[model samples]
Target: MTVENALAGLAEQGWVAEAEADEAVSRRVGRPARRFRFRAEAGCMLGFDIGLHKVLAIVADLRGQVLGTRRTAVTPALPAEERLAAARRLGHCTLRSAGLTAQDVRGVGVGTTGVVAADGTVTRSDLLPDWTGTDLVTAFTEPFDAPVMAGNDARLAALAEHWRGAAAGTEDVLYIHVGRRISSGLLIGGKVHTGRHGAAGELGVLPSSRWDTAPGRLLAHWADPQTLFAAAGAGEAKALAALEDFADDLAQGVAAMTLTLDPELVAVGGGLSRAGRLITDPLSRRLAELCLFPVPVAASQLGDEAVALGGIRLALNAVERELFDVNG
Candidate 1:
């Protein structure tokens, strides 16, 4: 079928096309002119960042304008389905606040804070014990009736930064979130590189660590990094020493990826990113000392919203693929 025909079909089916898809493909492949069914200004896209304490839902249109947003906290101890239901309710509330309904939404994109499989399952999560291997897509799909796309929260944050925040215009970039846990997200060629098994960028637990101890035992030292940072900020000498040591170890991990991926820029996010140069400067220097090449580092501009915006991008991509795949 012709591109225009596919575009019309998608629009009729309540899916909005991406404004840049055809242009991007044309520029990359030098193909004949094609278009997707996208509104210059139409309905909004919905995005959700499902976190341990709360679910954040943000809505935006094709022009990247945020229309409405809502945040709701729920018990992480609840079952995965219960948490997902709460999340869906939050999305509905946000849409209602904007004087719209689920029908008005183009698509739903989600970034879950844990290891997310391609099919939208939470493979594992220390933050949300009830979400392990839970199929989150199924939890919301029936209720919402819109197409859904799910991805790792950290990776989505990287995607958001690349598209609209600090990493804008960069094709090769690494976005690291250093809040509750340390995880890295990769953006190669303007897209998130989720690995073959959709397990890419799960960097919180070091691969070299033994896994037989216990479920959460691998990260038993988790609190140490935060405590060390707080002490260093307070000018404690011992804390300073510990912070420097931890920074060195983080640099080693980053350098290992640097040697392999050679990303152009490294953008750090999450609550700890506010530490700013305190962490980045030392880490950058250490990485440079250990690396064969120099790489620039920056802080995320969007802060926590990076992953929420990433969900918006994922939803846009999903609409294009499911409803406007001209190649299909």
Candidate 2:
């Protein structure tokens, strides 16, 4: 009975094909044993990183292999509506580049710079106030025919790190993101720990953490962050001292989380992670003094693509549900 339903669902659904019947196998089992092959191209998933400075879109197959990708520059001042339009256009372009269509997208997942609600709405966004109240589901719905969901960019980056990046095998991780924004996300028991309001790992919002404005202090010695980090890498006096101080500031909030949550590992991601040792080294040293027990600090292997890939991971999750759900 179960075999009949399995064949009917898989074959009729067009995601799998039945094997040829063998009389020898029938004689051995008293019935035909069927084998099926997974159709990797049967459907695709769309993932997007709608960030403060850019919008990134990635197209992937059921197997999580990235097929095509596109990104567009945006700004914090760019109106929310304009940014949404640019992102949607990128989605269309990315799908076309992959030789796929909107109908082929089984699910769409987004990582954006703000607090995402259960209904995929941005309830609050300190970086982009105009983005608040935007319905992310509706934002992508016009561009594709599929289920859509959105998550906080940093949180999703944590998911990506656990999926294939720095914290891949670690079950408990504290993912710290320091870019245009400073935030963190948690993976407890190998799962993305989105709190009750989808704001669990948000350490910047606290007044004492001072993470929201610490970048200003870090930039006091140099006008541009990239230039300052480069100088620090070369062992420049002012840049090094300033970065050390900044590292101390960054570690303060991280220590708070470490003492409380006691994550197994700490991952530093986002654009600043491109600085590599320039950022992670000082952060590691400061965390050593601040944390009760030593916690490993690692730079992101995925670099700028972490959040975009996390978006892909999320979309694949949704696709798997649709593809594997016999009842649905």
Candidate 3:
């Protein structure tokens, strides 16, 4: 096609706009090469995470810079519809804070605590009451006015770590998200691995695995892990012992994944990752003892925003594929 036809096509598709020709550029490239530039202000993306304790919404530009975020508490007893409504409110609030509307959103990405199917349905969930089998895509469509994509919260957090956080450069990684519940996400050959049944990294489901019980038992007496870690740091005997037991339990699951995948790095993320060295130091030591070889482990720098950021990445990819004809 001729340059005129090409420019016209791009303009028709709302991808490019004519800009004022600069004198210097016009002199060098002959008439400024028509001065067409990509329309970057076209739209943005919306990313939200619906967790057991809270719902967080983030608005990011196409380039993935977080513009704004809004969070709302989520009680376990709240109905699924109410929880979804809360998510919607937070999403709109984030968009408003970012000085944008739903119409400016290219796509919406949602991460929820559950086994998510490819079509954005929650296959199962126990973290939040009445959350199983939710058609999340449909639920968010009206509120966001865009195509919606959804994934498991832990898995999405792993994706965020891989994309721009802890596991950024690694081709193979094991991400363990430790919070009120224990779950994991796997990245193999630089891609998120969800397994045949979409249940990869669900180590907590194993009856013999301490991943299911250790954290809860530890928290039953202490207000939170941070308190226990503080006590352990201060040389308290009971706290030290409790931390050791928790580390040992966590290490068992890490060792199993290490032996199976031999990932380049193991990333620990989620709400509990904020404990920093308090958790990583002992967990690394125990992991080294359990593994045949020492595996490098790091805490997620993204903290609680990991899943929401991952949702942003997902939304970006979806927008690119649908609007830009680019494949991720």
What TM-scores do the predictions have? 0.79, 0.91, 0.91
Model 1 RMSD in Å is 7.1
- After superposition, the stretches of candidate 3 with alpha carbons farther than 4 Å from their true spots are 1-11, 17-38, 323-328
Candidate 2 structure quality by residue, lDDT tens digits, 1-328: 8877877787787777766665564356465466677777888889999988899999999888999989999988999999999999999999999999998988898999878987899999988999999999998877798889789988889999999999989999999998766899888998888888888878898878978878778876676788987898888998888877777888989999988889889999987677777778899898888878999899999887888889889888877776666672
State residue 196's C-alpha deviation in candidate 3, in Å.
Answer: 2.4
| Model 1 misplaced stretches (Cα beyond 4 Å) | 1-41, 207-243, 322-325
Error of 2 at 108 (Å): 0.4
Residue-by-residue lDDT tens digits, candidate 1, 1-328? 6756656766776455544554344265565554454463567788999887778999887556788889987766777777788888998998898888887777888998778888998887777776788887787677678777899998999999988898998999988776656778998998899997677866546654211122133224546446656767888876555545556656656777778789999898987676677778877888889889999988889977788889999988876675435461
> Per-residue CA lDDT of candidate 3, range 1-328, in tens?
4778878987997767998877664276354456688776677888899987889999988788889988989888889999998999898889999899988988899999878888898988967648998999999998778899899988889889999999998999999998878899999998789877678988888867789887787677898777877887898999877777777888888899999999999999977777777778889898788888888889998989999999999888887776557355
Q: How far does residue 64 in candidate 3 sit from its true spot (Å)?
A: 0.8
State the local distance difference test value for candidate 3: 0.86
Report every candidate's CA lDDT. Answer: 0.76, 0.86, 0.86
Each prediction's RMSD over C-alphas, in Å, is 7.1, 2.9, 2.6
